[model samples]
Target: MSIAKRLASQTAIYGVSSIVGRVLNTLLVPVYTARFAAAEYGIVTGLYAYVAFLNVVFTYGMETTYFRFANRPDTDRRELYSRVMTLLLLSSALLTTVLALLARPLMSLLSLPPGHERYALWIALILGLDAVAAIPFARLRLENKARKFAAIRLANILLNVGLNLFFIVFCPDVLAGKYLAGLRPLVEGLYDPTIGVGYVFISNLAASAFTLLLLGRELLDFRPQLTLAPLRPLLQYAYPIMLMGLAGMVNETLDRILLPRWLPEGFYPGKSNLAAVGIYGACYKISILMSLVIQAFKYAAEPFFFGQSNDKNSPRTFALVLKWFTLCCAMLFVGVSVNVELVARVFLQRPEYLEGLAVVPVLLLANLFLGVYWNLSVWFKLTDKTYYGTYIGFAGAVLTVALNFLLIPLLGYMGSALATLACYFLMAALCWWLGERHFPVPYPVARLLAWLALAVGVVALSWWLPVAEGWPRYGLQALLTLGFVGLVGVVEGRRLRTI
Candidate 1:
């Protein structure tokens, strides 16, 4: 089969787990928005932002390191796997311990309720379980065990969703005498309304633990290594990646983290700073339509690129991947942006949450640039110049921080959205420039930009059109979205067919 076909197939398999599972997970947005006030949901948003950062710390870059070393001709795959797992296991335990110990301080730092230190503890456990499982999941990717990887991921998401529904929805309903009144005793044993948003973290912790258990076979042959000598080379390669991951998280999530803290009181009339965060966070879910594609592609592309690193035609193959990736994401950008109101209403159950809907398009485009950056980043990875990724990541993170600081007080969450877009665009552009110098890929930059521009133009036209709400607006959006897709087909049909 062709490389394009293989990547697409792998992406589809991964997407089933990522895209499908996230769609299931995204169901919780409406539930959460419906059940909790903006201030309450903000806690979920804020804590998870910290989780993104800590996850980078916990896993540290060993997954990619494992892939790199495992692919080396001189390396023993099993020993390498064992070493990676050993390091991850030990580090995750240490980090979890430290996090648990500092849970109270973290609660204060994160501005959580005074007594909710258990949230930090639950997050610590979740991170440790997930960090330890990283290599096993990466191994599945490396071995082309996409089905098993998807199965495990899907199981985790399903279980998380089930537990969330049980605790957040069903248990509460039973207690309220909505139904199943006799089961109130059983429900009472499981659910506490006072626990409230903490259940989100608990559900995730349970799912992560369940996932580690399901990965038992992958863990069976693990041999612990206390000394760092054998892992020096891997660590040397991985630490830079971990740094990049840290900076990347800052770029990706620090806006959410900083928005509430930095914004002035009464920035949005009646809304509090945390309420702005809740709005931004809920609206941010709309962009996951783009991120879902990016994530699945990343899962497949990382291993695919590494395995194909030596192929003479790999650059052209990489270029094609970016082209198709951009095309698909551009379509998504246009589709989601044009129908932002509909999408917002579906996921955000309150009128206040809709205030940030304007940020959705900016974020979708930002995520598209992010996907492009991921494709461009394959160059540094394949060349083992991963430190360049670190540099670019920090540059973007610095820009993100500076931009958020400058803009949040002025524009509120909209400032955060703009900062994200600018940051990702810079990262993608910088990566492409650097990749050209070190390891050039024949990326179709002009054509890709044209498609992006067209997508943006279509969305703008949708906004400018004096169409009334309801089926007319939606019908117009449908036509415009179709029109963009059709134009891409006309322009790229022959090229796509050749691929």
Candidate 2:
């Protein structure tokens, strides 16, 4: 198969798991918004923001390191996998224990109520299970076990969704005598309504444990090695990646983390800062449509790029990847941004959650740039100058923090959205400039920018046209979205045919 074809197939399989699974997960947003007040859901959002940061620390970049070393010509793949898994297991255990011990203090620091320390503890276990499972999942990708990977991921999502529905929806209804009156006693024994949003964490923890169990075949060959000799070089290479991951998380999530703390009381009129955080978080899910595509591409592209590093035409292949990636993202940016109100209405059940819908376009564009940065990052990774990624990530992190601090007081979450857009745009631009200096790829920079600009223009026109609501607005958006896709087809028809 052609490189593009193979990557597409792999990405499609991964996308089935990521895109479909996340779509199912996204469906729970209505349930969450319906059942819990914005402040209650804010706890879920805030805790998960911390989870994103800790996940990087727990896995410590071993997944990418595994791909790098395992692709080396002289390395023993089995030994490398075993050592990586062993290191991950030990570190995850140590980290989880420390986190569990400090759960109460951390809860206080996170601004949670006095009695919610168990939330932190649950988060600790979830992170440890996910961290330890990282290598086995990465191993499947390296081995081209995309089907197995997709199946397990989908199963995990399905189970989480099932458990969430059972706890958050079914049990409460049963207890209320909505149905299955005889099961009320059984439900009462198992379910606590006061647990409320805690069920989100519980459902996730159960899913993580179940996923780890499902990967037993991958872990069958694992043997613990306490000695650091085999892991020393890997650690040397991976620590920078961990730092980069941490900094990247700052750029990606620090806004959500800082919004509630930094924003003044009564900033949004009748909403607490925590409620605003909840609104921002729920609206942010609308932008995940773009991120889902990026994530699926990342899953496939990382290994593909490394394996193709030695190919003569690899630069062109990389260029083609970015070209198509940007084009598709442009379509998504236009499509989702134009119909954002309709999308928001569907996903966010509460009218209050719709307050932050203004941030969706900015965030969609931000995530597009993030995906572009990921593509450009293959340069540093392939060159083994991964520290360059660290520098770039920290640069973006600093900018994100500075921008958030400066703008949150002025424009609220819109300011946060703008900060994200600026951070990702800077990172993508900087990565491209540095990649050209060290390892040039013939990326179609002007064309890609044109596509993005066109997308933005289309979205602006869709909004500015002042069409009436209902089918008319929907029809116009549909026409404009389809129009953009059609233009891309005409422009790239020959290239598409060849591919």
Candidate 3:
């Protein structure tokens, strides 16, 4: 089979888990917006922002490191897996213990109310379990066990979605003496009606624990072999990656984390800054169309890239992949940005949460650059110049923070969106420039920019040109989307046919 065909097949398998799972998870946005007020939802958003950062800390780049070492010619794959798994297990245990011990203090640090340390405790467990389970998950991907990988991931997401439905939808009825009167006491004992948003975190914790249990084969089948000999080299390789991952998280999530804190006190009447955070978070969900595609591509592409690194035509393969990836992302940007209003109307159950819809297009464009940046990052990983990636990530992090600080007070969450776009654009541009210098791939730069421009131009025309909102506007958007797709087909048709 051709490389493109193989990558597409792998991506489809991974997408069944990632895209479908995220779509299911996103279905809860209405439930969340319905059950929790904006401020309440903000708390959920804020805590999960920290969760993203800590996840990087807990896993500490082991997944990529595992792929790196495991794919090499001389490495003993089993021993390497065992060693990486052991290190992660130990670190996760230690981190969980520390967090459990200091949950109260950390909650206080996070500016939670006096009684909400349980959220911290739950988050700690969730991150710890997920961190350790990460290696086994990566192992499945490395061994081309995409079926098992998708199964486990889909299982976890389904469990989480189920629990979310039960707790948010049905538990209230039970607690209100509407159904299952006998279980009311049990439900009341475990659930507080006022803690509506907290249930999201709790549901996630249950899912994480269940996932660990499901991966028993990877964790329990073989006795763990402990050795420190490979430890030094792995850490040396991983440290820079850890920095890059952490910085990437900051670029990705700092806006969510800092929006509430940085906004002026009483920015909105009768609402805490959490409401602002909540609004931003809710609107951000609209951008997930792009994010989901990028994520699935990363899942499939990472191992594929590493596996093909030794091939004579690998650089050509990478270049072609980036070209196609850019085309897809551009189409995604146009599709989502053009129909955002419809998406908002359909998915946003609460009219009040629609206030932040303006940020969706901005963030969609931002995520396009992020996807491009990920494709460009193959150079650093292939050339062992991962430190360059670290520098780019930190630079983007700084840009994100600086822009957020400068703009949040003025533009609120819109400022955050703009900052993210700038950070990612800069990062992608820098990676491309550096990539050419160090490990050039014949990326079709002009064609990619042209595709991006066409997408943006269509989005601009649709957004700016006064079109009456009715079947007419819908018709225009559909045409615009189809036009972009047709343009890509025309430009890439011959190459695709050859493939």
- Which residue runs does candidate 2 get wrong by more than 4 Å? none
**TM-score between model 3 and native:** 0.96
Candidate 3 has an lDDT of: 0.89
Question: TM-score per candidate, in order?
Answer: 0.98, 0.99, 0.96
The stretch of ten residues in a row with the least summed lDDT in candidate 3 is 221-230
Best first by lDDT, ranked: 2, 1, 3
Cα-based lDDT at residue 494, candidate 3: 99
Q: Between candidates 1 and 2, name the one with more favorable lDDT.
A: 2
Question: 1-499, model 1: which lDDT tens digit per residue?
Answer: 9888999999999998999998999889999999889988999999999999999999888888999988899998888888888888888899999999999988886676688988999999999999989999999999999999999999999999999999988999999999999999888887778899999999999999999899999988777765678878989999999999999999999999899889999988998888888989998988988898888889999999999988999998888888888888888888889888778778989888887888988999999999999989999999999999999999999999999999999898989999999999999999999999999889989978887887888988988889888898899898988898898889889988998
lDDT of every predicted structure (CA atoms): 0.91, 0.92, 0.89
Alpha carbon lDDT of residue 360, candidate 2? 94
* Selected candidate, larger TM-score, 1 vs 3: 1
Candidate 3: stretches off by over 4 Å:
174-191
